[model samples]
Target: MERKKLTLLQTVFTAGVFSAVSFWYGFMFGRESARKELGGLIEDLRRGTAGSEPTPRSS
Candidate 1:
């Protein structure tokens, strides 16, 4: 039926969208150098990538 075909098409579209989004996110945030400096100047920056927590300071 047409309804069944439409449901199948929607399912495929949803799957494709999910796949593309996962691939894009992985490609964007999955590289070491993309998240970190190659070398040198690292000491100067000391930021240490995104979502990093700072060390606790002791009194």
Candidate 2:
């Protein structure tokens, strides 16, 4: 019984530590503005617009 309780406690502690480290790693590497800019660049490339601004097209 005591061994089982110890094993459960160890598992809980390990999980908590792992979660904290994962969260910190993601926060440190994830830059919101940079990600947004990269996404926009990708979209522009897909649309065949690399640099210039899009002008309005009148019918």
Candidate 3:
């Protein structure tokens, strides 16, 4: 009974650790992707071509 309990505890601990690590990795990847997308948008705005619609000319 003692050995079985210890094994169960160890298995749960390992699974928790694995879940935490995977979550961290996914968060980091999502952040990096957003950063890259934002950079591209900024560059487009700077170039005066943010979207397909043309900017209106004001006389």
Clashes of each: 0, 0, 0
Order of candidate numbers by lDDT, starting with the best: 3, 2, 1
The residue pairs found clashing in candidate 1 are none
How far in Å is the alpha carbon of 33 misplaced in model 3?
A: 0.4
lDDT of 2 by residue, 1-59 (tens): 99999999999999999999999888867776567667777877999998789544322
Worst 10 residues of 1 by lDDT: 50-59
Provide the global lDDT of candidate 3 against the true structure: 0.84
Index of the highest-TM-score prediction: 3
lDDT of 3 by residue, 3-44 (tens): 999999999999999999999999999998888777777777
RMSD of each: 8.3, 8.6, 8.3
Which 10 residues in a row give candidate 3 its minimum summed lDDT? 50-59
Off by over 4 Å in 1: 32-59
Model 3 TM-score? 0.84
- Looking at model 1, residue 21 earns an lDDT score of 99
Say which candidate scores most in lDDT.
3
Can you tell me which runs of candidate 3 are displaced by over 4 Å?
53-59
TM-score of each: 0.56, 0.54, 0.84
